[model samples]
Target: MHLSIPPGNMKGTMEGEASPELKLEGDIPARYVMPQQDRPSAAAGVAPIPVVDLGRLSRPDADGGAVEEEAKLRWALETWGFFMITNHGIEASLMDAMMNASKEFFGQPTEEKQKYNNIIDGKRFRLEGYRSELLQSEGQTLDWSCRLSLQVEPEGERSFHLWPKYPKSLRDVLLQYASRTKIIKDCIMRALANLLELDEDYFINRTTTRARALARLGYYPPCPRPDLVLGFKPHYDGGALSILFIEENVGGLQVLRNGKWYNVLAKPCTLLINIAECIEIMSNGIFKSPPHRVLTNAEKERTSVAIFYGVDVETVVEPAPGLLDEKRLARFKKIKAEDYYGTVFEHFRQGKRLIDTLII
Candidate 1:
């Protein structure tokens, strides 16, 4: 499928001259600004998201350790739809290099960065390049961030032209990170499948080589009035799962739970893993796709990298047969990944979410 933006509607132009640095002098355009009630709160104390250790789960133990780990995984998925993974096997140095490379790339002059503008070859959903806003409508709220998004898996399909050339070490480091994370994703998918009493490779096998694995590097510039703008809007991911790496010093990510918004604390060398809409459907509503948003900070800039994994576009997604019983019938109808994504893109343009459209 193809998605494009007209030349005249490019980002940062209407508000003023397009530049790398954020324009902090004028009032935020009405469309870019959100209502006061929608602004994030400065609550002093908030509960922290759960953190799970993969290394511990992998080590052999006689105390029914594996069972305990699986239980924890199920609880976190059912309760938070998100969790932070520690000792996930990715090297700390490599993670640092990836973060530094992202910062270096976005730190380049606006002219140089624009060379990799998201609308690759003018109009195609190639899934690799840079973009300030994914949904660019006439009055849609724009995110206060710049993003570099690219597909990193099934290596053969990579578009080297869309990859950045500067920061010499970027391509190498990102490839290394993606390779390692793919392993983690596979391991987690196996555990999730077993948790539902399905074959260990149920998820891994369905995610064909053509499945899209995208990495998004986000840079949120400090805002003059943080309360007036959003770094990102409230939305659920359209993919199967996402692993996020955030700058330890800057905080802005928040997830909605029990009708309250709670801040997601940035922990050093830890990856935050969250379930997405596809997983929710595959799990037959046993797992949730939570709504999350990023708030802007007045003094601190925030940067994050998210790796989104999904099945092939034409693959049919639905509640697994093993997960259904007399009392627990399928809660979601079967649908192709492409159809689901199309619905998501449509709802996104209207400032809505596709989660509500998946109910059986």
Candidate 2:
């Protein structure tokens, strides 16, 4: 309820002044120009989106428990649809003070960063908006970069009643890093229901049942023309799982498949695990939801945060009656998580084609 953006919508359309301090290099210029739908054409290779590490799942030394973290969290989510968490214990100075409070709230002054402007039922959180080339069709471009989206969740009522206001020492270091990222998102959903073998209190009581975390933060900036523009376009993560945290030697994140774009090689304190589409429809789809993107930089500037972790807009997500009783077929069809979030944002506001209209 504490919003404040005046100063005449703090002018923007790139005038002059400001826009400095960005110097992390290795071959800058947004890493070799790119933007033909984030050009991937090498048959998008690199294992869909796998990474898993979570400090080799080892919970038990305080007195020996949970059998070697349930066999390395079930062989790293059955061979990764993405993973790389570490120790499942967060606090690298609360992820460097939540990445230095997301570059000090996107470097303030855009009218005090649009006084936490998020609209939700009206949808208006733009934060540097730009993505309308007939919505880039297959490339659906529009991600030079700049975010802040918040919405902690029901656990002691997280944040985001409107926008970004966490400044009480960055909201007590992001609520103690969201109370240790809600106990590592309930031990990664009870290690994804014991890696599909189910019955671990069936995902440890669905990790606080009606859950619904959120947190974006991103930044990118520095595209003076990094190959004509684009540092986030591809797509494929409507939400049901996500963690991210990025930045350990600066590397443009990527993840597409059978079409090319694999560079997600970060590794400092770790955390990336994706697997979305409501956890690929509560795991019945056998964990997939790949397709990711983010690649810009004329020289430097690329902060991340992500968070996601879903299951609450009136939760429904079907298909697990014992994986539809020996595959009698029902891969995913009980819908209503608000109509799969209104069909992935009404197909991103009818720019068209986001598919996946619940096909169980």
Candidate 3:
């Protein structure tokens, strides 16, 4: 199903009345300024989240690495629900090509970029092509970033019209990127099933069959008032999982764990995986989905490619039957995948948790 951007989310909030483009200049406009209490501070400054080696995890059990790797995956999932992977097998040339395509697309003239405007038929607002954050209130503070979002999976569902063609290699490069990540997604899903003692393909069929994959390429330019604005607000992802490639040298991503926020730093060769609310529900609270946000850079611009994956809009979402027993009960109520998406998008705009209303 095509999930339209909610009523108040699009329209005149960022770009002039037509689309959600964020036109930034000298000092940021008043609407983009965040409340003082929400400003960013110095990062926690250490190795914040665990870094998992995918190569070891993919090894044969007899090699003495898979066992230990599985244990580490369990720890990362249970604790932070976020981690970076090394030796993930996506070639450096392909990774570089993807980022370069993103840079070239965003570097185009505004009018050139508008050809893929996300607003459809000048009425409904959607999440493909060029877009900005959703506004829950009329005068809501804005995120400091702009993005190009496109649906990539279930080939039949893809809107090729929304995909950029200016970069020449953009379409092919993204297709290859998505293809490679699909393999990793399968590998991890089986590992998760193994950890839970369910069939190794348990998560595979539930998510991959008709899943929707959205590739969001984000651009966060250097902000004049980095302390007064935010690149993104704190919210848990609504999908099952997300694999991200950020501008490696620049620091902007952070995750909230316990009572504080920690930096999620990584190199160009590594990609970060974040568990989302759906996974938390599917795992019956065994896995965590931490709230994360991006801070604007003061001296340089930052960019990221985040692909969100989830069950088809028609699937049913709830704790797995195998996960529920006499001692452990369902912590979340059952909801259709479409309604789950609606609720999650609304909660994101309102800056709240979907689980708060879902908990039993």
Candidate 4:
């Protein structure tokens, strides 16, 4: 089914030509404001998250480097469900180009951005487009960011018409970045399968050729009262995995670990990788899908691009055969990717979460 936004709705209050409501003239609007307890704080004195070096893993085990790297990867997935990786093989120049292209697109005038609004041709749900907020109910809280989401892989699925034309370089750069990141993702997946004692190609072979890949670019404008709004709500990812690239100087991403929030410091040319709910299920809960959120900065604007990797929507997601045992029975029922995603979106609209529903 296709859904389109009305022409009158083109005036976005979030990232485009800011409507009066989008501006903070008085006290922050109660709807946009977050509860005090949900606010973010500094993670001073907290232990930093582990950083995995892919280059080391690529080396032969004669020096024991590969052994140590594999252990780190296992611990990161089993414990934090996320990690940072350097020497990931993506060219530094390409990373910079991708980031620059994103900034240029968001910096455009509201009218130009509105042209690619999530609803295309005024009648279809072109998921690959722009959106200021994902409001599902009256007076729902709005995120303090503008986003451009597009499918980058499984090229046939992309709607090139919706891709931003103003940046010109955005498409080419993103396509290249996606190709490189896929290599990194495949390496990680192979390592994961080996870690589980399954054939190295288990995951690579199981994942359909038409697996869906989406790149979601987020632009957070400086907020007058950052404490009152959230850049993104706290939740776990619904896909199998996500690789995130954040602005170097503007830091606001936080992950909830052991009941405390820890700020994720931005590292130069490193991508943050995290397992998603589907991976958690596939591993029978051995790997976690940690909950995380984005905070808004009072003075600094921030931008992040997240590439979500997942199986085809119709593929059935279930615990891997090799991981299932009498002692470790399946904890989740087999669910189709499309159904899981649908549930997630429905719950998100109601300010709910899909985590609980995944457990048997």
Candidate 5:
């Protein structure tokens, strides 16, 4: 459906200039219309998102292969909260087709698109959008994008009820992506289990049984003055983990590290894996849940697809006792996942740093 950026909500109005207050939404536009072919005019460059060749880890024939894979996974997690993965075992054509369908969905006429608005249908919780109704408890400007969400329900529920209607062939693309991603996610979780010295089945079973798989198909329409709007504001994803397939050549993703923002430097065929809030909590502060944001383009529009694997909302979250020694345990405490999430979410609603509230 046709959605517009609120009045005066520009992204980078003060880029490279210094100011204490973040212009959270400066002159946000009143209307946002999706268009095809929206892209950044100039190429922004940086070292790419760190890449891990999973193939090296996948070779069952290699000597000490399992150990090698665990080490790589640990290194990647410790350094960057995000990374690109290769040899993920998903077909290239499938990815291409999914991207195409996502683009088409966002490009549809407003009337047609609005037909699927989750908010309007009273399924606000399950509906995908930049804003979450749960967080409505604290009023914040709605995020500047629209998205569609789907889940593989309990009992391998494959009913169309969970998936949105799209032109023919689009559904196939999404299903394939979801299925393949589950496989890669399983692989990554197993490696994570090894790193934690927990049973391989621990993560696999936790992830799959309570596994919550959802996709956000985003559309950032072209802005007259791109610097004035944000593709997305700086924030951490609230989930167990996330896998993102960003649009090729549409630069916007940036992550904060060492107090400076680093361009994620995305590329086609590279899948970005990001640690969510839950992972950080489980790691007991060893790994970070870095804040990330997307800058609006000065001259073009942008779009992206993100699939998230989250734990069941009702699940209790505490430091995985296995990962914490007495020394580490002393430095941290346990809290239910829902409570911790609410605390962080409240801080963000006031435009404050989410981690600052929970770390202490």
Candidate 6:
């Protein structure tokens, strides 16, 4: 696998107004096809991503076990940048309910799901509801999936009208699930700060004021020619971190490591955690943000619920001074969080890493 960054296409070049689900036949569309040289490969027998027991490090009566677990967490961040965590304190039942809510919403009739369409006036794209990624260029290869996105943080700024109403239980279940994830997010942030020997509130403080989070529910339908299309393109996330609830027994997510792609097998009851771009900058390159993507399934449909967490959009994101010293200098330039948010979709569409531009 390789990472490339090219200037992306602009709006008004898409082939259609509605998502491709309306056009699904057994055959893949020409626009959805990738170059033959860039098709996906099977993982075969490679090892899956790491799994960590996060609860050990957060135990109130933490002992030597905490010290050991902390080291594991640090290594995972510095090397893998992705891991599945168990015992982080969120309830299993709530997780199940959240997954069900996403399925319920996407399973609705087209007219019903259209009530909260992310495209307003059939032109502008809003991040608050059901939609597919915009094709900034006519030749852009499309993903084989649709999604529902909702702002789950900065509660005051959320657009409630875009929130779904058909499921009836969706709104309430999503709220509870978001609240619980916030607690886990804070805990991990504090853990990172403590590991770096900085103030425990270093990360949490930035997020408390203007931080933003979005819950993206992805629905990847079965494809006839799975090799011809991708469920998601290859790119690392552009936020601080992301927590994911992927459907077990269905395989799709894959992470790139050592120039080879490895399938991320799902565990029955673990929540996957991915360290993103901003966190790598904050760690002064001590932590890595791995590039990952999803594969289209030939027989089974895949669904996942993920919440992406980021610092305040207006704040300038840079490495912590404490992480720098006379021996080590900054490796990246300071960039406004809002800038990444603004250009992220275009970057993803073009198979580029926005953070690569910030590398010093």
Cα distance off (Å), candidate 3, residue 9: 23
Q: Considering every candidate listed, which one attains the maximal lDDT?
A: 3
C-alpha lDDT (0 to 100) for residue 264 of candidate 1: 83
Residues 30-126 of candidate 5: C-alpha lDDT, one tens digit per residue: 2222122332223444634567767766665547865666566677688778888877887788888888888787666555665655554343343
Task: Predict model 2's lDDT versus the native.
Answer: 0.59
Q: Write down the lDDT that model 3 would get.
A: 0.79
CA deviation > 4 Å runs, candidate 3: 1-26, 121-123, 134-136
Stretches off by above 4 angstroms in model 2 are: 1-16, 19-109, 112-114, 117-143, 160-195, 209-212, 217-240, 243-253, 256-273, 276-292, 296-307, 310-360
TM-scores of the candidates are 0.89, 0.31, 0.90, 0.90, 0.78, 0.90
**Model 5, position 145: C-alpha lDDT score:** 51
Question: On residues 137-194, what C-alpha lDDT tens digit does candidate 6 reach at each position?
Answer: 6556767777889998898987777888868988899889989888889988888898
> Per-residue alpha-carbon lDDT of model 4 for 1-360, expressed as tens digits?
222121111122343233344434354545577767776665423337778899887675688998898889889888888888999999889999999999898888777888888864544455688976544454466677778999987878888988999799999999999988888888888888878898888777645457888999888877667666788878888778899999777888888888887777878989999998888888888888888888877667787889989877767888888987778788888888888877886676576767667679
- What lDDT score is found at residue 258 in candidate 4? 85
Candidate 1 clash pair list: none
lDDT score of residue 346 within candidate 6: 78
For residues 107-203, what per-residue lDDT tens digits would candidate 2 score against the true structure?
6656565455453223433422211122223323344555665556665655435545645465566657866777777777766766677775554
List pairs with backbone clashes in candidate 6: none
Give model 5's TM-score versus the native structure: 0.78
lDDT, candidate 5, equals 0.62
Candidate 5 stretches with Cα past 4 Å from truth are 1-48, 60-72, 121-143, 153-159, 338-348, 352-360
Model 1 RMSD to the real structure? 4.2
lDDT of 3 by residue, 1-360 (tens): 122221111221233343355344346666577777777877555445667788888775676788888888899999888888888889999999999998888777666776787866654678787866545455587787778999998878899977888999999999999989888888888888888998887778778748898999888877767777888888899878899998777988888888687888877589999888888888988999988889887677777888888987877888999988899899999889989887787777778888778799
- Tens digits of lDDT, candidate 1, 218-248: 8887666677788888888887889999987
Count steric clashes of candidate 5. Answer: 19
